[model samples]
Target chain A: MLEGISYTDTKKLTAIIKERFNLDFSNYAMSSFRHRVSVAISKFNLVSADSLIEKLLNDSYMFDLFLKEVSIYTTEMFRDPSAWKYISETVLPKLASQNEKINIWLPECTSGEDIYTIAIILKELGLTQKSNITASFISNSLMTSFSQGYEIKKMELNKSNYLRFNEKNDFSEYYSISNYKAFMNSDLLKNVSIEKFLIAPMINPTMVNLIIYRNKLIFFNSILQFDVLTMLTNSLECGGFLFIGAKENIINPEMRKHYKVISEHERIYKRISKN
Target chain B: MKNKIILIGGSAGSFSVVTQILTELPKNFRIPIVLCLHRLKHVRSGFAEALSLKSSNPVIEPYDKDRIEEGKIYIAPANYHLYIEAHKHFALSTEDSINHSRPSIDVTFVSTASVYKENVIAIILSGANNDGAYGIKRVKDLGGITIVQNPEECQVSTMPVSSIRIMKPDFILSSTEIIKYLIDINNKAFFGK
Candidate 1:
């Protein structure tokens, strides 16, 4: 039946984590988190949630690994290639003309796929010198790895997506292959700063021109989703852009008024001035 | 009886059967039908629209954390794993695909079985893969009603055969018989039979 762990186990584990680490998972959706716990149990060759909890209580490194495992990093470069194309063609040029220095935020930057994607876009638009990006990772360890460069696995799909994103663009020009890894060029990340997402304040007081918090909100419950969306809305400037995953939607009627739809099908919204 | 949900899973050749089934169900059918059919990753829209054409119920591809409503047909969106939460809401995951398919039949069926438990009525239909076999077996283990379309009547029998090999399902009915059974259940529910 694959009854790897029970919901009661999740409650117990989250309570312990809260008490020990002061990290609250009380609002995170239970189904996805529980499934991730099951995956962690098998991946670490632990017997059950009890052993996992023992490891977490005693060893600090295990907690980092646990966080990494639970966090979803299944995105590819230029996922929803059309959305990237739209940003390149329409979003960036308009922002560049209006602002002297465009600020962008990539919250939940798990593997830096979106970071590199947006960096490349900025470079192509000659906005790299005029742009600043704040990339937030789930863990400090992730920040270090993403800084080194993205390791290109599944080249075919990423390459195909890049091609689809812009047929006129050459995919190989963006990065160099060394020792079977595609290291993103250092020039692209010159203005990009990395920080740990959870350790920092959830609401960023610094306003940005664009926030691409895509595909990550599905991991949270509706209440948490609304809370996160509100924070993102606040982080955005009066006319800043916000993009989420194509399959996702802002369900709360109250939150809908904060942003006007730029592309309804693409899930792109532009912030409206608060009345 | 109050919190029952029906889950249907199919892969390769089950679309027409699903359309026919949805067409036959009356508009007043109260139980929510959740469909986890395999679809192309890149094609995001239009599946639910096409399904809604002949459906008596409103067919929708629900957003994450969307509440389950009666008389609506929920289709798992492309490129996401659909899970039924304990509070009767949908949870979408961008986690890596299972059995090489996102919107995987197994993921949806297993999650629904876990949440709904004995109140689930799970049906496995025509497909080329064994994706739904483990999930159907899970439903059976949890005392939920399990049905597999008779393999002989399927466009591709591998899915039904795979399921049958793992567990003894409650019924192996043809398409016509499956519709009849579902409508009969709806009739009984309406009449309090």
Candidate 2:
């Protein structure tokens, strides 16, 4: 049997976590939190949570592991066809008409696949040269991985997913295959750049015409979700477009009022003026 | 009485099993529950809303930095690991998937063990492959409590039986019995223990 840490230890650990991460977990379901910590501790080969915390406090490497343990970074290119379609059909035209520089943010961009895919789509649409585009990612490691354009052979599945999103073009045309790996065209990275930062603050201060922070909010507790939505609402220029995951919605009564649904099923919203 | 939290992990036939478990639990129950269910990347439907209709407690797809509260159930949204930070606030991450699953049960259960310790309870339900077994073992290691739905009773026995063989969970009851045990734990935590 796995020996659990004592309640006293758990309290100390929670305090340490709060001090470090600014996350308050007292309201979390206890059983679930305990199990997740155990898994992380086991991975570190540590015998106890207190010891794990000690190591975490002493070694920055453990912080990375802790970040990895707690964060889920799964993403793909053009993840939701309909949402992208909405961007192409509804949002893009408006940006095109204004002829304004378009700034797009992919807050939780994992591995740069999604940003590259969008760049390709813009290039195909004749928007890449005409419009100024910027994409942001959350993890420095992922940014580095994307900069190299070298990925494991595991991307074959994503190739199929790319085909699903853009059937008219051959997905293979965008990359060179080596062994089992698919290396993205170096040209795609010319205009596209990736930066690492947390999501909630990205929305404040950066005034952008469109933000595609899809599927990244589902992991937050209610307060974080609301906070992010508010920040997103505040950051968007009037009439800016906000895209979210198909399963996620701005359901909080206060948050819902700021944006009007553009496509109900696709979870695309357009920010309307508070006035 | 303090409520005992339950964490369940599964993939493949999780939709049906989740429905069955919700159907079996009484409507008046007050314990908090969390789940990690694997799903396709871009599909969207109100999973929490749908489950809430069947569950006694309110069902919600938690937001980032949302606080965990009793009498509410949180589901890992598609494509993210739902983690509990200190003080019961939730943290959603886009870190790489473990065992090929985002919103991995192992990730959630392991994180839970670190924060909840012996106050926790974990269950491995129906799934294909061995995603939750390591997580269940972690739960056991912490002395938090562990349960697995009987393999024979599950639609896919690989997950439950594999956990049984490896984790040696405290119970291997049917889905209905699993619900009963959860309710019993909730009562004990809140009223007796």
Candidate 3:
């Protein structure tokens, strides 16, 4: 639907996607969308956007390719250990006291790394039964892939991060490592659920206590950023927590009014209670 | 240096030279300079602060689409590749790193060369890696003046040497000579002789 060399192309694509699939990508940032389409063009070996549009019109399976190309999926156990340590030592205890049932949301979880990490932490804190996690992905493929679990390929990286984060408990006690791969215990991951959810604007009072949407905002344009962030703030209960990636360094003034800094170094914020 | 934006690419051992150059430049020096340096993914602090502490020109890690302001040194943040638009706004990419590095020197150099064309003043300095080799040639191809740190005078010569092998540079200056060259060009441009 998109034509060459202007915003008109992406606008057309958005209309077509909405009309046929009932999915909305209209709020996606134009620069990132353009870059993803460019990558997809090269990846598919299509000469031009016209050819790709033709393929998509003829066959719907091309939607899968578009989905994969646009979203970034990375999974690592305890990716930023210092932040995890802060969450474990400070954040989890605070949340445990506030509510008997701690509902957590990981919006657009690519490979379920952060969600699983949260589950493991909850288990370590003796709050596994008290926790409920809903991890979202746009595609069924992602949901299935994450639910199936993963062999921890980068064991040393995980171990080093965990060691740096918290040496109180031996990192290996949480999972079974065979040869080089760590097979995380299903018992630890019992409270987590993967769901198909597109990030759209909405309001949900007291629905979730914490939302981890790290590093994902870098993929979208500023307009979509503002939209998604507002959606997140509205969805979060008052006094809930939010964590963004380290590289998402600057916080704009508009977002500043809605949250209070828990840890500027860790990029953690607590949603302001507007009561 | 020549009334154009100065673009510098370095990795590994070039940090000392970069600090020296920035510290030497006067606060009045007005050409906008950008740095594309390879850095660790998890090191989100210290580099910009360290540079700012030493340089006359304030060093900053720019946000996405941050406008180009003259007389300040801009460094690419960790885990993002930086590019400049003709509109003079910084753009960043989080795609999988090229040359095993985010904030890749060559990626930024290529974008800068395209935008600034003949007005680009590019310098490839000391580094242990080959990231800036093709970038120097790209600037040269676009009629932008390219300079390399003389390999004989380098702390780690791999990057400068690789760039030199790719194409003949307009100048191969030592650190002292580089500062001198920059000052000379600044004077020439300002005084119109």
Candidate 4:
């Protein structure tokens, strides 16, 4: 009966984890899965996958940490410049035409560079004041650090990026620097709002026009990824834009039916009709 | 004499850089140092303990609604963005990540610039991405001092190089030199003897 317990037991054990944690290991590439499992094991100090499963069964905090460990929160400002450029040139302008307030969501924001970068773009384009922007993250503590705008050093680098975006005005005009610290102006960040949550709840369905969840799905088990994708698709309004990270793809098959690919290379898609 | 405030931002390779700069400062340094280093959410580590070991002054991780005091180094705790209020006190928010980094340097620097303006000293150090450039420009535009780590000396030069190319800070020095300059500036601004 339990003769091949080591190998078959591990397999059954993994299935139990998938069921209990609501994570589907099948979504991630095999290499990524291995890497994630190794990282999780080391991070949790579990001796084996069976141990991890046992730990998860008992500890909710450990289970939550496990989810965070498996998720990829890495991101950059204008990570794919062309994608941002496309939004600045196309989606933003269309929203401008309507003269209606717009809201944006950048989920799984790791450190907040991407959200602030989007705010800067909106400010440069003169849309920040008009639109109501919001970004959400998985961590409340990270959100607090981002809101403060304190960093060791990198303003000069951001200025270079602003120039690439053709922000012609003196970059210095936006901040005050003393003693190696750069303080950013509140005016530029005013309309660019921020929030924190794991998923978009149904209560706030109509508030967003664009949702940028780039590069985040690659870390999720396929089921979690699909669940998130479905949530994002449902959250968007008709003709809204959904920008995924360069490496991530929407492979639910049903996603293709609802959203049209705007830029294949940039992973930008547009909601075609109401689902 | 008004106490000078300094905010520093970095990521990727900031651990050693921050420790080096803090170690060089005096124990009785009469200023506030705020840090915004991007870190992973959850799993609290000994960042403050490590920084305090290298520096003479006390280093502490700031909590939500913490009061800002002179001569203390307040590190933004993991997973939170650090911001300064108009009253020069600390405030934390659980907003979405900006530029995909929480505890974003830009958010902290930008917010500080709004309230502190010319009174703020902003520095950019070793990092993998350009998170603080726009914030540095904002500080400079408000007539504050701006400094960046010399790209050649940075472990990860992308952040410093990008800031230099874009913002053109008043000074670009190595980590040791930056600490010296900070100490000198603080002495001048505070002691004025």
What is the fraction of true interface contacts found in candidate 3?
0.08
Model 1 over residues A1-275: C-alpha lDDT tens digits?
23437888888999999999888787787777788889889999998899999999999789889988888995688888888888889888999999999999998778878888999888888888999999988878888887776676667778888888888989888778998777777778888988878743576767799999889888887788888887788789998999899878888899988889999788889999662
TM-score top scorer = 1
Model 4 root-mean-square deviation: 21.0
Model 2 chain B worst lDDT window (10 residues): B86-95
Which residue ranges in model 4 land beyond 4 Å of their true spot?
A1-30, A40-69, A150-160, A167-187, A221-223, B1-193
DockQ of 3: 0.30
Question: What Cα-based lDDT does every candidate model obtain?
Answer: 0.86, 0.71, 0.78, 0.71
Give one digit per residue, the lDDT tens place, for model 3 in A70-141: 777664667767888788889889999999999898887777667768887898889989988888887888
State how far residue A209 of model 4 sits from its true place (Å): 1.8
Quote the positional error of residue B39 for candidate 1 in Å: 1.0
Candidate 3 to truth, TM = 0.86
TM-scores for every predicted model: 0.94, 0.71, 0.86, 0.49
Overall local distance difference test of candidate 2:
0.71
| Higher-ranked by TM-score: 3 or 4 | 3
Q: For residues B58-161, could you state the per-residue lDDT of candidate 2 as single tens digits? A: 88877665678887888888777777655766666655677788777777887777667776788887788888888888888888888888777777877887
- TM-score of candidate 4's chain B against its reference? 0.95
DockQ of every predicted complex:
0.60, 0.21, 0.30, 0.01
Report the backbone clash tally of model 2. Answer: 55
Model 4 chain B: weakest 10-residue lDDT segment is: B87-96
The DockQ leader among the candidates is: 1
How much DockQ does model 4 earn?
Answer: 0.01
Query: Order of all candidates by DockQ, from best down to worst?
Result: 1, 3, 2, 4
Tens digits of per-residue lDDT for model 4 on A200-268?
A: 443465547888776566455446667777778787888888987544567677767888998875678
Whose lDDT is higher: candidate 1's or candidate 4's?
A: 1
